[model samples]
Target: MTTAPTPVPTPAATELSGGAGASGTATPVPRRRTVKLRGGSWLATVPLFAFFAISFGLPAIAIAIGAFTLSSDAETGAGTFTTQNVTDSVQGAYWTSLLSSVKLSALTALIGTVLGLPIAQAVVTSRFRAVREAVLSASGVLANFGGLPLAFAFVATLGNAGEITKLFHLTDHGWSLYSFTGLTIVYLYFLVPLMVLSITPALDGLRVQWREAAHNNRATTLQYWRHVALPILFPSLLGGYVLLFGSAFAAYATAAAMVGATVPLISRSIADALSGNVLVGQGNLALALSLDMIVVAVVVMAVYLPLQRRSARWLS
Candidate 1:
């Protein structure tokens, strides 16, 4: 039997192993020193960190400080501090406005979640790519389409004397577009689309193999979703709800333009306070109101971050 030729070591392997040289002795070869990156790659994020400090951190600090400072002190740089502004913020008309904003945000978020989830699922499951593309594209546009133009469009189409109302006798049935319910409807216009964009990726992340396994186990469609899909998607759904809540909570221009003082949203109150509509020095009250808003947002973020981490862990 012919013996197999001895395997030859590659040049790289020879160098690494200190292979025999012409002297018939092992010659040690120095291993190349790898340039260890000492966290310099993190320097790339400096600009982003600086931007947040300037735009977000600094402003947030200013808001916290201004919330405690008296209006007179604010003007004179005295830095005199008190809790009266914060206390006053949650009382009387300010309290009423804060409650109203919370109610509106909760209502819109609930309705948006319920409606948007199915629409997003349908788009993701559909075989018609063109239709899905069209819907997603429209959703992207409508999610950002708000403020003055949206208010104008809705007013022109659904307001009491608007042509659609005139055509359908909507006002005859008490379908006024200037009321709280009307505002909810208008807010849902953008919020539902925003939900679509937010949750579609999560729905898509549902692996086909999951469904196949469920089917193999004789799980009904509802059973599969209940036992498999919904649980996995719960975190993402909650995150979307929180996002929608914040969007509605912080909305200013649309409510300001459409409903004016009638809605009693906190954002409207902020505008009134800041513009000296309440009183010249009530700008301090605006800062207090802003502090209340910041607290609510912080709480919402606290809830959202935990859910987000859970979602990433399970989905990935």
Candidate 2:
């Protein structure tokens, strides 16, 4: 009489049987759980959104609105909408200063682009990894190591009383810190590092095969740069230009310290307006100027959008 074989337990039921005795206890499987998001992520994001809006966006909006409004009368709490501020900004002191600022930014961008290319090329094409690492590290440090401290460093190095200046007896030929040339020099100190960082990737994007092919074709140095390197690196160069333009445009501290005189650069102008006496309605102009900055920032961002799109397309 062949009795039916004992039924084999299913995988779900079978456990503790690899080496343990039959009397050994089997472990129960943990129940699986399904978690569903309540679609509250958007709601959860409200606080952060509100915080930025109140802190940054709202203030910007208020400044813009103030830019378009006349100062409120201290006694009567009366004010009117006017175009004078905008007109003044366009036609008065702001226009010339704005032009100067634009010119300075353009010059700085050009210089940075021209100088940064070789440095970036060197950093990218170097066979020695240590050299590349050193350049990258130094670029990072120098890029962020500017402001008042940088100005002082320059002074200590090149000032009439400076060690190097004195060592060279440069006192016979004094350095002019208050000139456009001086501003440009200080700006280059900040600008070159930015260019190096910005263009390094573009320089790297130039494949060795392209250079080898160019050489095989008997391409001259200028020909290689014109035909092969420039097209590949154009996007990075444009990006570098934009970066340098924005940096020089919005620069405040270095220019301020170097100038030592109240030059009407946009940033200094804005600073003056903002730092006006609080005892009077001077704060209103400051708010107006802040809005002006917001407007300028918006325009700069607008310029950036097309370049970014082009870079994306090229990369893709």
Candidate 3:
């Protein structure tokens, strides 16, 4: 036989040697190299990161620290850690203001959801592109149309000497611009449009195929909505409600300008505390109130995120 029989390579040997041929000389495999970011690449984000740190992060840190600390004396400028500010924030008039804020936020969120859902649905299902565009454009503008200008606009329309008040003789009918009812009306001006903008996408995500499938399966319109549509829409509806609640709860300038501290809102209370109108040496108490609002807002967002995630599962 002269030459030795050529050895057969095993599959494992071939794989390990990078599929080397029968010659037995192994081929080198090239390793994947990770691409690292260049110094210039990171520079682009520095400005944005710095802006957030200065504007939001620093202020938030100050509020958190100040909430739990009290000055020993104005002259000494020494702060000692304490929870009395938190305690005081939840008692007496502060408690009442907190309750009023909760009630107002809840009421406005409910009303906005109820009124806006139908409008969102109508706009989403509309055949005309112009109609949808107009509605959406209007909603976008109105949703952001709040603060002092919004308050002033409502005042010009519903105040004591307002045109509607004079025309309908509302003052004689016992309507007051500075009352809770009036505040609710003013809130609705923005709340309804916000809800519309929020829920429109959710409504648009409802596929026509779902309704067709339901109809094909001999399902009634009510049954399809009750079983399929509602379940899918529930998460979105709840998310929108929580978002609206947080927004209304944190509102300051509109309520402050419209009704002053007459409505006893948490925002107004915080303002009073900071300005020394409510009590002297109560700046820490204002920070505590702010912390409470932050906590409530955090809770609302926590609830909203999960609901939004669940809704996205179906819609996506």
Clash count per candidate: 0, 0, 0
lDDT of 2 by residue, 40-115 (tens): 7788999999999999987777777777778768688567887666666655666667777778888988998999
Q: Report the error of model 2 at residue 283, Å.
A: 3.5
lDDT of 2 at 296: 68
What lDDT score is found at residue 291 in candidate 2?
58
The TM-scores, one per candidate, come to: 0.91, 0.75, 0.84
Best by TM-score, which number?
1
lDDT of 3 by residue, 1-316 (tens): 5998888878887787787865967777778999887888889999999999999899999999999999888998799999999999899999999989999999999999999998998898889999999999999999899999999998998999999999999999899999999999999999999999999889889999999999999999999989999899999999889878988998899999999978999999998998999579899999999998988888878877887888899999
**Candidate 1 worst ten-residue window by lDDT:** 71-80
Residue 251 CA displacement from its true place in model 1, Å: 0.8
